[model samples]
Target: MSAPPLLVHLDGGVMTLTLNRPHKLNAIDNPLAQALSEALSSAAADAAVRAVLVLGAGRAFCAGRDVSAPPTDRDLELVQAVSRQIVMLDKPVVFAVHGWTVGAGFEWMLDADVALASADARFKLPEASLGVFVTGGLTATLTASAGLARAKATMLLGEAFGADEAQAWGLLWRVVPPDALEATAREAAQRLALLKPEVAARFKRVLNEVGLARFDRAIALENAAQQALQTGG
Candidate 1:
């Protein structure tokens, strides 16, 4: 039997999905992304998963999209579909970030409700620096997290930041030691889950609307700005 693309574990109204690609730093490969999307959908409809926590099994949260395979239409579509689904999921999706977070793997959590970073974690938006102006909606999200000037510096300059720095800059809600990340995240999720599941989920949905619409607007602004930068406006 083939190993699962992701691991799903549900307990006490909290569903935690582990991106189980430690060997590849849990990069968002095609199969893993599709499975992750489906898992989010499943957790949303289960009526039992009041809150969802997404994390990686090994050293990293996600090292971005797997560039091992040549970029293709299928690859792009899969990632895009999963990203949209992540944004559409009603349940709150929290992330536990460790190691490197880049590319689509970073995009997946960009659609999350909240993020907790390990002290050792580092984040960078290298899409533009890689000759690709925009590979994901992260420029906007990261900008929203850290502000326009910081966002521009990070994305355009391809700067990387430590976890505590991320929190101070508003890139993450919280940061903890590497060993404490999972437990801390789980405790936080469980606290939210202890409340009425339906109510919690509804709150998540409403907050998503408020946050995501702004997120879209921010991304649009970034996109237009990026276009101008590339087009010599």
Candidate 2:
């Protein structure tokens, strides 16, 4: 049998969710998408999991959708669901990204509470070039974090950028050497785990309320666009 797509481990108060399909650079296939959504849901429900850390195994973080095959409707829905779970989960969600982070994977990082990247990490938003709309409320989050002009250029061009560029664009909390990324991210997650659960929840709730006021609406609009494109509307 093949290995599972997601590996979940709880250490201290940090729940580490590792994307295990390294052969495809942790690309989001249907099974991987379902696994990620279920894992995040479990993290939200489990009291022992004070903070959640997402990592990718092997060479890269995530290469976005597994394009070897077209995404099914269920895959699309799960992708959006997982994005909501990451953003809406009361607990702190941290992402440590390296290698290629593209398409939906890039959006997942934006949905995260905090994201750290290795110096060699690369990012791209290829949805526009690929003729698909983005999920994970990226339309709102990217514009809010990177400003309207930068966000439009980044999405419209669908060009790849380095970690330093991503950090400069206000996407990453920090960019460390490739070897130091995991440790740096763990430290951040541990610090977040120290916060009182109720306070952390409330902090995230209020901050998101103000910072991501358009998140839900953006998601709805993107979903409609995606459906239209899929149905040739």
| Clash count of each predicted structure | 1, 0
lDDT of 1: 0.75
lDDT of 2 by residue, 1-233 (tens): 99999999999899999999999999999999999999998998999999999999999999999988765678779999998999899999999999999988999999999999999999999988888888889999999899999999999999899999989989999999999999999999999999999999999999999999999999899899888887889
For residues 1-233, write the lDDT of model 1, one tens digit per residue.
86777999999988999999899888778889788778877876788887888889888888887778755556666766666666667666788889998766666666677789888998876766665454446655666666778867776787776777878887678889999999999988888777786676688668767655565564455456555655568
**RMSD of candidates 1 onward, in order:** 3.4, 0.8
lDDT of each: 0.75, 0.93
* Per-model TM-score on C-alpha atoms: 0.86, 0.98
Question: Which candidate number would show the highest TM-score if scored against the true structure?
Answer: 2
Model 1 misplaced stretches (Cα beyond 4 Å): 133-136, 214-233
Clashing pairs in 1: 64-102
